[model samples]
Every structure is written in C-alpha cells, then in structure tokens.
Target: MTDAQDLDIPTEPLPASVLTGFLGSGKTTLLRHLLSHPEMDETAVVINEFGEIGLDHHLVAEATEDMVLMNAGCLCCTIRGDLVETLRSLYRRRITREIPPFRRLVIETTGLADPAPILQTLMSDPLLVERFRLDGVITTVDAANGEVTLDAQIESVKQAAMADRLLLTKCDLVDQDRIDALTQRLAQLNPAAPILQVENGKTEPSSLFGCGLYDPASKSLDVQRWLKAEAYEHDEGHGHEHHHDVNRHDERVRSFCVTYDVPLDWDRLNAWVDMLITLYGQQILRIKGILCIAGEEKPLVIHAVQHVFHPPVELPSWPDDDHRSRIVFIVRDLPESLFQETIRSFNEE
Candidate 1:
C-alpha cells in the first residue's frame, strides 16, 4: 500500500470539476452535450457507475473504448481504480505524453453518491490535491421531477446544497409555475449558486467552469464573482426570506450570511473557524468568506467544503469600498443563531 504522505505533490495542479445530481437528474444528458461542444476540445471525462454492470459509458453518445476521442476533440474514460487513482493516472499520462494534451477534467458521480466525499477526496488526498485543483461543482436538476425528488430524497437535497452551479434540465417538459417554484426552493437551499435552465442538456461551457476563486482565463483571483456577496445582499434586501418547511426534504438546510463590521483579528478568527469546523463540519456544507483583518493590508479569501478547507489566499486589494468581513454559510441542521452567537463570542474576546 502506498503511504499518502510519500506521494509527490505536483507544482502545477490541473483544474477539475465534478458533475453530479440525483438519479435521472439528467447528468449524463448534460455531459453528452458538454462532450459534443467545441469548447470542450481539450477535456478528459471520468464516469462512475454504481451497480455491478456498468452502463453509463454506453449512455455517452461518442464514448466507445476505454479512452475515446470524440469528434469535437474531447477524451472520455471510465473510473479505473477510484477517483484518486484515476486522477493520478491522468496526470501521469499527461506528463509522459501518453495521452493527448488536456487542459481540464470533469468527473461524473453516480446519482446516489454524496458529492462531499468526492470533494473531500479532491481536497484531502495530498497527491491528488497537488496535481489536481477543484475547479467547481456542477449539479443537474431534473425540472420535471426535481420538486418531488427533493421532497422525497435527502441525497438530492445534498447535491443541490453543495453545487457551485445548479443546472435545471428537462425544462421543456415542465410548466413555468413548477419551474419557478423549484427555483425558489433551490435558492433557499443555496443562494450563492446561479441556477441556469439547461434545455436538452445544452448550456454554455463558460457558465459552468471557472467558478472557483482562481479564474483559469485571466490567471487571477476573481474574488467578487466567486464570493457573490452581492447576490446574498440582494436576496436579503428584496425580502426573499427563507422559510423552514416542516415537511420538505431540505427543511434542515439553510443559507445565510454573517457580517462583521470591525476588522477581524487574524489569530482569533482562525482559531474560531478551526473550532467551528472541528465541531460542526458535517453540518457546515459550504463556507466562503472575505475578511478584512486588523493588521493585514489586503483582503483574505477563505473557502471550505465540509471539513476540508483550501489554504487562505490574500488578494492584492479589496474588491470594493466595503471593507466589512462577510462570511456566507450554507449549512444543514445548523441554526443561524448558533453561528451568530459563536462569531459574536469570538469578536468579544
């Protein structure tokens, strides 16, 4: 067995994204559309099948062999070992010129898979983390059955909660009223993610990728767009209050922002965050924040998916005149009052 710490970390990490959703949520359909796009020319794909007999590979239109180069120039492959092994193999092949040069990678998870574990694998595995960077998460929502699925399945709710982009599929089959209601429900669960209607799984590739703090095109930190604090503010100002429903599947999941006007003490804030994640990591689905520290010259960017946290990066300057520290939390079964109180206690000390 290979020891995790013994593996070498790559200097230049490849950007990779996860495509996940519930069963029959149109993940494969959307993937087929993406694979056909010219923009996905230098991309590699990995599909994970759940049962003994794997059939997801056949569902992809142009996928034929273990590694198939589609007409549009993208490469498609199934998961060989696990997610980590597959990523390592891809990196090794790219290094040795065994495969075509690929710029990005996309992994499709089984409908029943919890996105958090895959995300954790991406961030936690030392070898994988060094070679592959988590670009973002794209979740496909079945508009026709989204509402019912969300109400009946907890896994479906989790997929939406952890998504960076929520793509609504099968819009043509559903009425506008149903779509609107489902949209509202999704917003309550994950206010920061932009929901786009994907017709027949066709969507602009630009919209799905580049969702992380580091912009692949500009090679710079696009903190404002990535944080999306303005969206949270707008939702709050417009009285888009999130109501907790007793009967809904995501009744326990909530999205809210906690703001601190005073500049935070770096050491104190770090300690608080460490403790928070240690205690309630499972409940804290996602965390993104911009902080103005008392002694720091630039704003600090923090991102966490469940218990795993990316190393904090400091931007050259603040995005705007607003210097207040804003931390947005998307949590499940974690009360806003508890979060507020914990922060308040930290600030007081």
Candidate 2:
C-alpha cells in the first residue's frame, strides 16, 4: 500500500460513485480496467465480494488483507457488513493511517441490486454525508442483449435511466444497427446522460469519473458539465407525452429538461417540489437543477434521487452568462406536458 503520509489527504469530503449494471453487462471488466489506469491510482473500491468481481488475478502480488493495493496504486476491498458501515470504516481507516490515502471511492453493487436504495443510503446517512459526497452512477450495458434485457427486466431499465454515465460494452460483438437501436432507446430513457461505447472495458477514466457537480481534477464545481441540459434541446418537439407502450419496460420512462426565465420564489418552489415528491416520488427516478432563486444572486443547485434531495448548494457565481433556471427530470409514466403544466400552474398561483 502507498504510505498514507506520502499522499495528500482530502480536506473536503471524498467523492464517491456507484458502479452498477445488470448481469453480464461487463461492470467487472470495466472496473478492472479502471483500477489499472494511472488516473485511478489514488482511488479505492468497495465491492460486494471478491469472488463476484474476480479481480484477484489482476491485483498486484500484495498481501490479501482486508484491502489490497493494486500495482497501479488502487486500493480494493470487499463490503464489510453493509454499505454504510463499509464506507464509515474506510473513512476511519483513511484518517487513522491504516490504509492508503485514497482520494475517491467507487462502490460496485450486485447485478440484481436496486440502485435506488444505494443512492438513498448515500444521500440520507449522516455519517456518509459527512465523509463522502455522491459523485454519480455509472452503468454498463451489453450491446448484444441490452434491448432484450430492457424489455424483460425492470431493474435493468432503472439502472439505465438512473445512470449519470452509461457505458455501452461489448460493441464489437454486435452490428452497428443493434448499437444504434440501443443508443436511441437509452437516450429516450435518460436524455441527460451521455452514452459512451466501451470496447472490452478499455476506456479513459476521465469519461467515467468527475460526473458530479464537483470536478475533482479542476477542484471546482462544474455545473454545466454535470447538467448537460443541452441534451434535452433535441428532445423538444418530440411528443414524449403521446408515446406509450406498457409492454416495454423503458417505454414507461420519460426524460426531459425544463427552463424557467423568471427567478423562482424559494418558498413556493420548495412547496411545489414537496408536493411533487409526495405524490410521485416513486415515478420520479432522478431530478437535477440549477435554479435562479428570486432573492439569490448565485445559482442554487438541487439534486434528488427518488424522494431524497441533497441539501441545496449555492455557487459563488453563475457558471455562465445565462441566468435562466434549468431543471432535468428522468421519470417513469409521467407526462411531460402535465409536468410542465404543473410548473405553470404553480407560477401563476
């Protein structure tokens, strides 16, 4: 293990990301490549089990203790009891000079696991909030079978819709036509997330990391990059409200971005959001926004997964000249027109 004293301990909470995918989606392969990358050298990984990830052979010839330091300087460990406990233990070990001073963390969930609970745990657990902030969710999709999987498995649809970055793996095994179809479907399921094609887990760490509002590499908040609201510009004029296919799992989902030119009253906005969550929390898969509050000069950022919202953060200044509020929503069976109409009704009231 790299000596803790030699590394720079993070002054702020470490950014943690969740890596999830359906069975045979190549999460382990992608993680293996990430662990070996030079850019991920200072990263620590928590997996459900060592046997599940099958990373033993790839690890360096180091002692197989609770945490193993890879040749590229990455630290790998299996979950201890539960996720919250494992993360707390990792932070404790890091501060006490027991393990390498890893700057970031990645948690790998089981193939069959629901990502919402994991995200909820990260957002709601006070201890985790104090030590680590959620970076984003990275999901892998198998190019050959993604369509079939999405049709049959609701969990796979959730994994895709909730991803901040979607990786299309095993592309070489399929034709471009299949890849194109899957890409279009994923875009429909989640417009804001960028879909990247991964060839046998060989991808740049930059593409997968820094997905959250904070850019660890630049040590600054990257609201524009995190939001990617432009992705929804293409979504406009597309009648997502009219499309309905209850048979297909992804057909029930809709993703869109809304912008408000007027500054919003904080209290009214809060009330509206509370009402929205209270009534449709389960259908609302993810919500992210950069708001222009009525009395605030700086932009306010809000993030939510299901019903759990992160504490609002105000930037020192707006990211750009545009002062309009932009909000992105990835929801299931929620009519886009109805959602926009609700906002209109609230604004009028």
Candidate 3:
C-alpha cells in the first residue's frame, strides 16, 4: 500500500464550480450544452444522482461503466463516493494517468441540495482547498415556473440567493411579461449576480465562470468584476421604492449595499464581520465588498458564503477614482438597519 505521506497532490489548483437549480430547471441540459463546447475539453463533471434511477447519466451521451468521455474531450462522472472522496479519487486517477487530465471541475448538485454544505466542504477541507479553488456558483432558474417555485420553495430561494450567476432557463417558453416579472424578482433576491438567459441550456462558457477574485485564465485578481458593487448600488438607488409584501415567499430575502466615505478601521470591520457571521451565518447567503482600510494603500476584497470566508485579498490599486468602501449583502430576513447600526458603532469607536 502507498504510504500516507507519499500521496501525490497536484501543485496547481484547479477551479471548481457548482451548478444548481430547482427541479426541472434544466441543470443537466445546461451541463450537456457546456460539455459540447471545445473550451470544456479538460473539464471533469461530477453529477449527483438523487434517486436509485439516475436519468441524467443516460441523457448525457457517450456512456461507459462509470464515466463518460464526450466528443469534445470532457469527462463526465456520476458521484460515486461522497464529494470529497470523489474529488480525491479523480486527483489520483489524474496522477496515475488512468484518465484524461482535467484542468477544472464542475459539480452538478441535486435539485434540493443546499449549496452551503458543499461550499463548506470546499472551503474547510485542507486537502481540497490545496488542490482546488472555488470559481463560483451558477444557478439555473426556470423562467416558466420560477416565480411559483420561488413562492413555494425555500430551497429555490436559497439557490438563487447564493448564486454568482443566475441563469434563467426556458426563457423561450415564457412570455415577455412573465420574463420581466421573474427577472425583477431575482434582482430583488440577488442584486449583485448578473442574470443571463439560457434557451435550451445554451450559454457562452466565459459568461458562467471566472467570478472569483482570481481569474483562472489571466492568473490575476479581477477585483472590479469580482466585487460588482455597482450592481447593488444601482439597485439601491432605483429599486428600493417598491416594497415586497411580508406574505410573499421571498419577502424575507433582501439585497442591499452599504458604502462608507472614510477608510474603515480594519480591526473594527473584522470584528463586525466575525460577529455577524457567528450570529447569522445561515441567514446570510452571500457577501462581497471592496473596502478602503485605513492603513492599506490598495483596497481589500472581502468575500463570504454563509459562514465560510476566503482569506481577504488586497488589490494592487483601486480600480477607479472612487476611493470609498462599498459592500454588497444578500441576506434573509435581516433588516438593513442591523448592518447600518453595526457599522455606525464601529465608525464611532
């Protein structure tokens, strides 16, 4: 048996993305389209089978015993072990040349799976962290039934709230009015994530990936695109007048941005974030900000999903002339006043 200390781990970290959506939201369809692209040649896809009869495997072409190699050179496999084991096994196979080497991984979660657990695994597991990086989350929203699903299903709401890119699938089937309404609702739920339309699971690969602080292709941090604070700022100015009813399914979900004119105290800001996440991590779906810390010349980028946060990264310089700090929050059942009061207290001290 190979010794534990001798295990071969790849040095270069690969980007891994999570694809999630409600049932009948065209997640598998989207995956099929993505696998057909030439750019996806080196991607390893892991799909979760919810029930005994997993139809997604069959729907995807080029089936073997456990894995499928597409014509475009992508490797697709159903989840054999738990996610961690599955990932580790893939790494071993790559090391041994048992399978085609993959540069990236795409995980397709089951319809009802809460992405938080998977994210926690990716962030907290030391081995996985060293081998793979979280690129971002892409959530497919069914334009036809999305509004009703969001109305009745909390899972759907959480999926949308935590997504980095909101893909509205089946848009061709819906009328303009329905599309407009759903778009508005999704924006209300997550103002920071850009909404993209996908008809029959067709979308450019570039649009879905590269959402993290580090760009996979460029090997540099794209702080401006990663923060996207301007989206939330625009929403804050133009969209706040419309009030959602308490009876609405996503009434508790809120998206807003907070800006500070003066450079913030790093210790105070860190303490506030720690306390907030400690108390309300579950309710906080996502947080991203560009902060002008008092002592730092370059701005600091803060990112968090639920309770887990990536290490804060400092940019080389501010992206624009705006030197103010802007933080975007996508949270549930939390009032803006709570964050405002906390920041105010920190600034006062």
Candidate 2 lDDT over 1-349, as tens digits, reads 6666754456788888988988889987888888788988778887653343454334422332234322221112233226677678788777766777888898877676668778888887898898888899999999999999999999899999899899999999999999998998888788778899999899998888888875545656666555777777654676444343668988887788888889998888888788888999999988889899998888888988888988887777787888998989888888777677788778765
Query: For model 3, how does the per-residue alpha-carbon lDDT over 1-349 read when each residue is reduced to its tens digit?
Result: 5665655455668888988998899998998899899998888887776665556766765653235322211111234226777787777776666677788888888887777777777776788887888888899999999988998898898889888899999988979999999999898788778899988988889999887766646756665554666666544456455566567668888888888999999989988999999999988877888899998898888888788887777777777889898888888889887997899897775
The candidate with the higher TM-score, 1 or 2, is 1
- For candidate 2, the 10 contiguous residues with the lowest summed lDDT are 68-77
| RMSD of each candidate relative to the true structure | 5.6, 4.9, 4.7
Ten-residue segment with the worst summed lDDT in candidate 3? Answer: 68-77
Question: Cα lDDT of model 2 overall?
Answer: 0.79
What's model 1's TM-score? Answer: 0.87
Backbone clashes (count) for model 1: 0
Q: Candidate 2: TM-score?
A: 0.87
Q: Candidate 3: misplaced stretches above 4 Å?
A: 1-11, 63-81, 219-226, 234-241
The deviation in Å at residue 4 for candidate 3 is 14
